[model samples]
Target: MEVVSEDIPVVIAFTPNYFVPVATCISSVLRNADEDARFHFICLLTEALPEHMQQLLNELVGELGRFTFMDLTGTLSADIYVDPKYTIAASYRLLLPDLLPQYDKVLYIDCDMIFRNDLSELYHRVDLDDNYMAGVFEATLEQQLAHMQVIGCAPGTYINSGLLLMNLKKLREDGMVAKFLEAATQEGLEFPDQDVINQLCKGRIIGLPPFWNSIRTFLLPQYKADFLRFYTEQDWQTVQRKGNVHYTGPKPWKTFTVAFDLWWRYYFKLPKPMQALLIIPTKLSLLAKIYQTFLGKTILDGTRALYRKLKRNEG
Candidate 1:
């Protein structure tokens, strides 16, 4: 099934810790890609190499067949430190704006994603008219705009940060990246990196259907349509058509089992005994979380996810 690079139109993703699960998800998508447009998938790691991780990374690279690696701190223009408070996942916010220049149109996926089909279709779907950037309509563009205003960006622009197909050429030409960095600084009211892109590219960015980034497609509770105007049906019609499933929420790693059971299948040539050990804990954690997710048959929502903190506070 593997062919030489195939000179595919590029797709990029970034991950810290060199996650094997995410790498598997990414590879699965690439494997199914059209030969005409093979994938140029690139990923980044945010930390110094640990011996175990180093070996794992090597194994990942070997199994990947074709992919690129970029060390986080090594590639940045300047050292970015968001309040040393929470081990900030902020470097990605800083790095993305700068990294946008390196390619034409890049698909930047979060580490917690899986690929259901060849990304070539989505890559082709990006239509940059009206300054719109493609992503789901969840918390619709209107709500996204409200969030943007809070962060000092023009309203009506906000995209889900999880999986972004960025048009780097357009971004550079419009001076959006510089603007994003300025808006994203520590002193300048902290907004997530995804919000910045949504704000800056509002109105002009196109909206992809909800299926491409189906945050709650399978995981969340389902509901029926209005049956009158056909509006809800329209959304479902759009949803029925898609090629990828993005598992973007409290992942199975913290819980007893990941939502999509599909993520459990990724692997390398590592010894079976070693894999057995790794998967066992991963599965156990997922199982334990399923109970934790439930508060008497109702999945915990919002602040309840911070049960540990609640205990500390109570203590």
Candidate 2:
């Protein structure tokens, strides 16, 4: 079926390497959405997808929703600084206003996430009357304040770009795309695209509730202090209420975590052959992590014993 203008347009950007996870993401969204819900996915690609993968994506999109694959290779200028940690796809969201000018608004979601709630609620309920975009605030006030300073924006304006609701008309009218690209070229940002979005949008962004873009902060103990430093009890409760889960740290596919099962529940829905190919690398990666941890522990234990013996001899 053709995607009508009335249907919500959701955008995701990723390289060919993340095809499975992106497929899983779309599958999860389809599973959670209402039967009558309509969505048009705009997949901005940094590289060409494999034939098998393209077939898989087509099968998934069949009759459920509409999708458009956009090749963004060689679109960005050489001067734009891309973080080594991320692919060029990470910056693709910056081009939406220019590439998709027909749409008034579009939702940009990261491939490393799963949808647990109906997206229609988010699409229709949030009012972007005067803002360029909407997103959940970053988890930490300190980080928010720091980034705000970096962009010279006020406090409480920093937001995560992982799941963004962009007002395309407003963005284009304000010339934010050029501004963001200019900032990217000049600044040494840790998260280049995200920093540019938060910096440029500033007070123009509407703060969505935490439920909309809940990062998996509760899963890691090391992050607890930072999480608590920013999020309140109510914020944690919102996360529990089942919104979009951003698998930020170690992806569930690569290792076992609190949310690994949740991710696998959707992964198993894929074709059996795909399951076989995907699980092997994930299991091997887990084993590799375990082996590295054990080796480091043994080396530390041996060093500690030698240090104690030396201390005793000195005594």
Candidate 3:
């Protein structure tokens, strides 16, 4: 049966395998909404996702009933055409034209993000003067060059695609999809999608801030940057009180161990018990991801060593 749900206005994302918890972006937006109905969270995929990822995302979606699943491969919607490449988020830009009519505006965020505060400001943040479609801001040029080098593009001129506040109508009018495909094939363009978009939307873009498109904070980088702490720390207890949140990487779900628990605590205080239960394990799974990350592995190893020590003490 066709799922004839009401059309919504808000953010959108195209993720496969449920590998990343993009919920951190939606969670804060939903929680901080005074209107409660201002936006919706649309999840686009070719098939049904894992039941476990669905559970947490469902909890995050809350009563807004804002979460949705799209089987693009099953449908002839002609809406989304994402090339499954790790480069420039090819699949995401494909979601533009088809997604435009669904919402007046939408913010697309990578799953590696954690919301430290409300981000509703992004909803209607488009700059119409230039007919510019979407806006993303970064903190440092060094970081920008780093991101460029990641997807194989040259240094000094790359933009991150982790978080986007898009004006869908503008994107469609610009024929953004065809433009992207053409740009992707352009010679000397190494960072397929990111480089194409930066050149396509270049001056027309409305510059926001570093926090908006905080990039490369999650993955392994040549070195660490401090701006990351601005988004992820949960308790704010440590001297290094978490400020930065990762935008993409294996360490994604791990932020929950620090932040999601605090988020759930506040969720329970304001919401109900059942709702809280629905959210807690999401934290575990995300945090469990630390087993593969540097910090997670180091912590887990220390934990095991401590456990053995305690057993030896007791013996």
Q: What TM-score fits each model?
A: 0.65, 0.83, 0.59
Query: What is candidate 2's CA lDDT for residue 168?
Result: 93
Q: For candidate 1, what's the RMSD?
A: 7.8
For model 2, the local distance difference test gives 0.77
lDDT score for residue 283 of model 3 = 49
Model 2 poorest ten-residue lDDT run:
284-293
Q: How does residue 77 of candidate 1 score in lDDT?
A: 37
Q: State which candidate, 2 or 3, has the greater lDDT.
A: 2
What stretches of model 2 exceed 4 Å from their correct place? Answer: 1-3, 141-148, 153-156, 218-232, 276-279, 282-315
* CA lDDT of every candidate: 0.50, 0.77, 0.50
Task: Pick the lDDT winner.
Answer: 2
In model 3, pairs of residues that clash are 82-91, 228-244, 229-243, 229-244, 230-243, 230-244, 231-243, 231-244, 233-242, 253-286
Candidate 3 yields a Cα-based lDDT of: 0.50
Task: Identify the runs in model 3 with alpha carbons over 4 angstroms from their true place.
Answer: 1-8, 12-16, 23-25, 32-37, 50-59, 74-90, 139-157, 185-190, 217-244, 254-315
lDDT of 3 by residue, 7-47 (tens): 23444444553333455456655665555444455666656
The predicted structure with the larger TM-score, 2 or 3, is 2
